[model samples]
Target: MHPDGFAADLARKPDVLGRLADTLRAGNPWAPVVPPGIGRVVLIGMGSSAYAGGVAAARMRAQGLVATSELASSPLLPAWGPDTLVVATSATGGSVETLDALRRLPAGLTTVALTNTADSAVTESCGAVVELAAERENGGVACRSYQHTLALLIALELHLAGQDITSLVASIEMAAEASAHLLDTETTWRPQAADLLLGPSGMHLAAPAHRFCSAQQGALMVREGPRRSAVGCETGDWSHVDVYLTKTTDYRLLVFAGSPWEAQMEEWTTLRGSTVVGVGGTVPGAQFEVRYPGDDADDVRLLAEVLVPELIAARAWQEQF
Candidate 1:
C-alpha cells in the first residue's frame, strides 16, 4: 500500500462521509432487503470489516435483537434459519473468505452485501447490495470503507430495531465535521501523538466496549500501513490483558478515552510510567490529548477518533520510504 495514497484516502473521509449522509438522508438503503420477522442477524467479514461488524452486532443486541458478528473464516458460524438475515461486508467486494461463507449459506436466504464496488462478486452472490459509496482507496487501505461500514451498520441496526434513523444521519454529519477538524489540525497534534504512541515495543490501543472497533481499526491502520506492532483491547479488558506490557516494555498506549474503566487503566499506566495518548476525551494521566470538533459525543468519537491514529500511521508509513 502506498503511504501517501493512504493519507489521501483518509483526507477524503469528510467528503465521502458527507456523501454517505446525503445518501442516507434520501432513504434507508436496506429497506428493500430487510424484511419483517427477521429474528436473528448474522454478519460476517474479515479484518476491519469484521471489526465494524462486531460493534454493530453488539449495538443491535443492545436493542434486543439477536445479532452476532463472525469472522468469515470461522468454522462455527451459527446455523441459519428462515428468520435469519446474513450480511457480508467486504470493502473490495472480493474477500475470498467472506464469499466462501456466503456460498455456504442456503440458496435464496435473505443475504445482503455491503461493499464499495457496485458490481463486485459479492453483489452477485448476495440477494441485495448496499454499496458503501466510500469510493476507491488507491492506497490499498480500507480507511474510508471502514468508517462508512460502521456508519451504515449503525443505520442498519436502527432499521432492524424499528427505530428512526434521523439521529444516525445527524451523527454521520457530525462525524464528517469531526474528521475535517482533525485533518485540518493534524499539525497541532500529529507529532506529539506519533512520538508518544510509536514506542519501540509498538502501540497498544483501548476503547470502551461499545466503541472497541475504533481501537481495532486504529491498531490495524498502524500495522497495515506502517507495519508496526499494535494491539487493541476493550478498555476494561486491558487491566486484565494488557497491563503487564506497561511494566516490561517501552509501552505506548493510545486510549480512545471514554470508558468508565479509564481510571483503572490510568492507575496502572501512571504507576508504570508508560507513555499514554488520549483521544476524543480526557485520560487523567495521558501524556498527550487529541481533540476535535465533536469529541464530546460518543457516537462522534466512534466514527472519528480513529483518524488520529490513522493520520499518525500514514505519516509514519510515508516517512519510512
Candidate 2:
C-alpha cells in the first residue's frame, strides 16, 4: 500500500465530516431527491457503500420505516410494487452491481442513487440522485467517502421522516472534533500496531449497525495498508467461528467497546493468549486501549472511531517501507 496515499485519505476525514455537519446545519441537502410516499425502503450497494446502507437501514427501521439492506451483487429483492423505494449507494457512482440492481428494479419503482459523482453510470440509471460532496480517495480504501455517505444517508432518513436534525448535527460536529484530535495524535497508535500486527486481526462490534459499518471499514483499511487478513463480525457471532480460530492460531482481536458480549469475548480471547485491542473505551484486560472521546458510540461516533484502524494500517505500511 502507498503510505502517503493512505495517510492522505485518513487526513481528509476531518474536513469531509466537518463539511457534512455544515450541510446538515444548512437544512436538508437531500430534499430534492427524497422519494415520494415511500412504503418500504431497500438500500443496496457494494463494500463500504453496502455497509453504509446497512447503517441507514437500521436507523430508518427504528423510525418505523419499513427498511432493509441488501448487497447490490445479490439483492434478494422481495416482491414489491411502485411504492417500494430502492436507494443505491456507490461512492464513485460506477459500481456495476449497484447499477444493475437499479436497472432490475420494477420500472415504475422509485430509485435514487447516493453517489459522489453526478452524471456517472449510477446517476444515469436511478430516477433521483443524492450526490456526496467528497473528494476522491487517493488510496483504494474508501475512508472519507464512507464517512460522507453515512452522513448523507442519515440526513436523507431524517428528511424522509420529516424530523429535525439539530441534535444529530451537534453529535456530528462533536464527532468531527474527535476525528481531528485523533488525526493529530495518530502516531501514538504505532506501538500498539507493532504489538498487534504479529498475527491476523479480527474486528467485532456489539451492535449490528456499528458492526456492519465500522468492522467492514476496519477490515478494508487493514487489508489496504497492512495487507493482512482482517475479519469483521458481531460480538456474539465471534464466539461461534472466530473464537475457535483465535484459540488455535496467532490471531489478534480488535473489539469495539460496547456490549456485554465484548467483555466475554475479551476474556475468552485473553484466556487463549490472543492479544485483544480495544477500539473505543476500555475493554477489561485488553492488551491496549484506544480511547475515543465520546460517551455514545452511535453512528456519528464512527466518524471518529474509523481513524484508529487507518492509523494501524499506516503503521504497517511504515514498518514495511
Candidate 3:
C-alpha cells in the first residue's frame, strides 16, 4: 500500500462521511431489501470488516435481536434458513473467504451484500446490495471503507429495529464534523499522540465493549499500515490481560475513553508509569488526551475516533520511506 495514498484517503474522510450523512438524510437505503420476520441475523466478514460487524451484532443483540458476527472463513457458520438474514460485508467486494462463504449458502435465503463496489463478485452472489459509497481507496488500505462500514451497519441496525433514521442521520453529520475537526487540528495532537504511544514495545488500545471496534480498527491501522505491533482489548478486559505489559515493557496504551472501567485502568497505568494516550475523552493519568467536536457522543466516537491512530499510522508509514 502507498503510504501517501493512505494519508490522502484519510484526508478525505470528512467529505466522504458528510456525503454519506446527506445520503442517509435523503433516503433509507436498506428499507426495500431488508425483509420482515427476520428472527436471526448473521454477519460475516474478515479483518476490519469483521471488527465493524462484531460491534453491530452486539448492539443488535442488546436490542433483543438474535444477532451474531462470524469470521467469513469460519467453517462452522450458522445454518442458513428462510427466517435468517445474512449480511456479507467486504469493502472491496473481493474477499475470497467471504465470497466462498456466500457460495455455500442455500438458495432462496435473504442475503444482503455491503460493499463499496457496485457490481462486484460479492454483489453478484447476494440478492440485494447496499453500496458503502466510500469510493475507492487508491491507497489499497481500508481506512474510509472501515468507517463507512460501521456507519452503514448502524443504519442497518436502525432499520432492523424499525427505528427512525432522523437521529442516526444527525449523529452521522456530527461525526463528520468531529472528523473534520480532528483532521484540521492534527498538527497539535498527532505528534504528541504518536510520540507518547509509539514505544519500543508497540501500542495497546482499549475501548468500551459497545465501541470496541474503534480500538480494534485503530490497532489494525497501526499494524496494517506501518507494520507495527499493536493489540486491542476491551477496556475492562485490559486489567486482566494487558496490565502485565505495563509492568515489564515500555508499555504505551491508547485508551478510547468513556468506559466505566476507565478508573480501573487508570489505577494500574498510574502505578506502573506507563505512557497513556486518551482519545475522545479524558483519562486521569494519561500522558496526552485527544479531543474533538463531537467527542461527547458515543456514536460519534464509533465513527470518528479511529482517525487518531489512522493519522498516526499514516504519518509513521510515510516516515518509513
Candidate 4:
C-alpha cells in the first residue's frame, strides 16, 4: 500500500475517535440519565446506520438492559413513550424513512441522534447528536464514515456497559499497525471472491447469538456493489427454515458464523454446494478463502465484521462498480 494512502486512511480513524469522544463529553455535561428503567432500548435507522446501531443495543443488553433492535422501517413498529430511548441513526442524517421516523417520535421521549452529518435533518431534530466520522472524503458512499460510526458506537457501548474500555486503547492503536499488514494481505481475498460475488448482488448470514439485524446493514452495502438485490438471514434459519427457497439457486449467500447449526451447515454446504467465502471453517469442498487480519476478518468474528464485505463489495469492486 502506498504510504500516502495508508497514512491518509490511518489518520481518518483518530479523527473519528476524537469526534466520538467529544460527543460523549458533550452528553456528560448533563448528568447521565436512564429512565426509572429504560423500558426498552429502541434503535432506528436505515441501511448501515441502523444496523450499526444494534451494536449498542446488544452491548447494552450484555450490561443488563432490556434491549430490542429494529430497522427504522420495521414492518411492525415499537411502542414509543417517554421511557423509550430512540436512537435514530442516519449516515447522511437524511435517509428518507429514518428522518421521517425521527420526525415523528413522541414528545418528551429521550431521543438521541447518531449520524455522520451533524447538520442534516435527523441531527437537527434530535435531543443530542453523536456526530460521526463523516469527513469530506466520504462524499458519495460512506466507507470511512462507516468505520467511524461503528468504532464510536462500540466505544459508547463499552462506556455504557460499565466496562473499562481502557484496555481497548492499546487495541485501537494496534489497528493502525495491523491495518498496514492487513491491506497488504487482503490482495489474496480478491481471487477467492469469484463465487462470493455471484447471486443477487450480495448476501448476509448472521449468528443467532449475535446481532441478526446485521443482515439489514450488510444488504445495503452489498446493493451498492450490485444493485440487483440483497438479503440478510441466519445460517440456522437458512439451513432448516429457509431451506426450500434457497435451494433454487436464484440468489447468492454470504455466510456469517455463529449458532450451533452453522457448524453443520459448513459440512452440508459441500453435499449441496452454496457459494461461500470469508474467515470461518470452510464449507466442505470450499475452493475460495478471504485472508485478512483476524481482527479484520470479523466480518465473521464480531458483529462489526460487516466491514470486510463492505470493503470488498464497495472499495475493491470500484472499477466494476
Candidate 5:
C-alpha cells in the first residue's frame, strides 16, 4: 500500500483545517461582527450545512455574543431588531433551505455567506462572502468544505469579538502539530483495522448536538469506510437507553469526547467490547487517543476527530476509485 494511502482515511479534516488555520492571517479577524451594537446574531442552515453554522454559533456564544443557531427553515425569523446579524453557512452554497432564508432576510440586515462555491445562490443573496473551494469529489457528503467553514467562523468570532485571536491562533498551531502526529503515527496502520468495522450490525458513535453536527457527518465517512450503518447519538442521552441496547453483536465504535464524563464513558465502552479510538485532548482511556492542542483544545480535538473517520471511510471506498 502507498504510504499516504492511509492518508485517504485521514484527509477530510486536515484538508479543511489547513484552510481554517490559514484564516489566522486574515487581515480582518476583528472586522465587524455586526453593525454596531447588534442585539442578536442568527446563524442559519440545514443538515451538515447547518452544522457548519452551529460551529460558528458556538464560537460566537463562547465570545459572549447573544448568538443563536437555528435551522434555515425555522418558523421564526428575527427582523424587527436592528442588531441582527445573519450568518449563512452552506458547504455547497446551494442548499435549498439556506437559499430560502437568504431571500427572507429583511432589507438592511447584514448577511455573511460562507461557502465553497462563490457562484451559488447563498452567495448571491448575502451581503459579504467568504469564498472557499470545496475540494472533494461529489464532496463525500460534504467534507473539507464544512470544516473550513467552521474554521473561518471560529477565527472570525475570535477576531471580531475581541476574545484574543492571537491565543486562539497559537492553539490552532498546536492542533496542527497534534493532527500531524496522529496522521503520521497513530493513523498510519489503521486502514486494515477499518475492515473490522464492516459488518451487518450498525456502528454507534456518541456526541451531543454540540459535537454531533460536525462529528456525525465525519462518522458518515467512517460508515463509508467500513460500508456499514453508523448511528451517532449524544453521550449522556445514549447512556439512558441506547447504550443498554449494546450487545456483543453490535459493531459499536466509540468516538471518545474530552468531557469530564469521557473517562467514565470510555471505561464503559471498553467493558462492552466496543472498538474505541480516542481523539482530542481529554478522551482518556481510549485505545487510540490523539491529543489535539488549542485554546479550546478539547473542542478542536472534537472537530479534528471527524477526519480520522473520514479517512477510514475513504479506505472502504478505495476500490471504486
Candidate 6:
C-alpha cells in the first residue's frame, strides 16, 4: 500500500470523531427542537451518504417519526408538502443528483443538509445545515466522512426525539478506541481478503440499511482493491432466495448483523460449508467474530463495522491504482 493511502486516513478515525465529540460539547447543530406537526421526513443522498440517510431514517422511525430514505437519483422522489422534512446528505455536498433533489423541493418546505464541505451546493439548496465537525474524506473512499456523517445523523435523531444524549455523546471516544482495538487484533483479516484462491464473496446486512445499499461501499472496496466479484443481499432475503442456488462451499460469506436472524444464517451458511465472519452481532458456528465492542445502544457500531471491509480494500487495491 502507498504511504498516503485510504488505510492511512482510516487510521485517523479516532481523532476525527474525538473532535466531533468536542464539537458536540459546544452545541448540537440540530437544535431549537424539531417543529410540531411534522408529517414525514425524506432523507436523500448518493451512495455512502445515502446509506447514512438509511441509518437516520431507521433511528427516526424508532422514535415514532414517519421517515424514509431515498436515493437522490430516484425518479419517484417523495411528494413534498409544508409538513414534510426533507434532508439531503452528501459527503461533499456536491453530488449533482442530491443537489438537484434539494432544489426541486417546494420553496417553503423544510429542508436540512448534512455535509462535510461548506459552501457546497446543498448548503444553498437547503434551509439548514449541520456541517460535520470532521475533515474531508481522504483516499477517495470517504472513510472518515462516512463515519462522521452517521454520527451527526444519530445526534440529530437523539435531539429530535427529545432524549438525553449525554451518555450517547460520551461513547464516541470509546467507540473509536474499540474500533482501533478490533483493527489491531484482527490483523489477518485484511491480508486474507487478498487471497488469490478465495472464491466469489457475498455480504449481507440485517438492518434498516437495505442490503444492496449497505453493501454498496464494501462491494466497491473489494472491486477496487482485490479486483474481484462481490455480491450483496438482505439477510433473510438471501437466506431464502440465493441460498438455494449456491453450493455452500462455493463462496465465502460475511454477515453484518443487527437483527434476530443471526443464528439462523450462521447455521444455514455452516451447513453449506461457507466461511462466515460476523460483525456488530454474532452468528453461532461462524469462523470469526468482529464484535461490536460497545453497548447495544451504542451508535458506534455504525461507524466501526465498516472498517473490516475497508481494510480489505486498502490492502488489496491500495497500490494497484
Instruction: List clash counts for every candidate, in order.
Output: 0, 0, 0, 3, 5, 1
Cα lDDT of model 4 by residue, 1-321, tens digit: 232332344345445445544545444311343334446667787666656667657766877866666777665657756677777777777888887776666688877777777688887778877666556543255555665655655665555555655434444444433444434555566445634654553354444445464555566656765443666666567666555544565434555544566666666555556666643334333456443344434322442345445545555344453
Where does candidate 1 stray beyond 4 Å? none
lDDT by residue (1-321, candidate 1, tens digit) is 799999999999999999999999998888888988888999999999999999999999999999999999998888868889999999999999999999888755689999998899999999889989999999999999999999989989988888877998999999999999999999999998898889899999999999999999999999999899999999999999999988889999999988999999989999989998899888979988998887889888899899999999999999999
lDDT of 2 by residue, 1-321 (tens): 367787887877777777777877988866776656878888889998987788788888888888888999885876578788788899889998888887778778888888887789998998888878777777666777888888777887788788878877877888887787777876686576556744644433333334457777777777767677777777767777677776567777776667567766766776888777777777766788777567355654566677777777776776787
Which of the predicted structures, 1 or 2, would earn the higher lDDT when compared with the native? Answer: 1
Q: Candidate 4: what lDDT?
A: 0.56
RMSD of each: 0.8, 2.2, 0.9, 5.0, 4.1, 3.1
Cα lDDT over the full model 1: 0.92
**Ten contiguous residues with the weakest lDDT in model 5:** 1-10
Which is the winner by TM-score between candidate 5 and candidate 6? Answer: 6
CA lDDT of each candidate?
0.92, 0.75, 0.92, 0.56, 0.62, 0.69
Candidate 4 — which residues are off by over 4 angstroms? 1-40, 74-77, 137-139, 168-179, 199-216, 250-252, 280-285, 296-300, 315-317
TM-score (C-alpha) between model 4 and the true structure: 0.75
- Candidates, ranked, TM-score: 1, 3, 2, 6, 5, 4
Candidate 3 TM-score to native: 0.98
> What does the lDDT come to for candidate 6?
0.69
Clashing pairs in 1: none
Model 6 residue 226 CA deviation (Å) reads: 4.5
Cα-based lDDT at residue 194, candidate 5: 59
Candidate with more favorable, higher lDDT: 4 or 5: 5
lDDT of 5 by residue, 76-95 (tens): 97665666778888877788
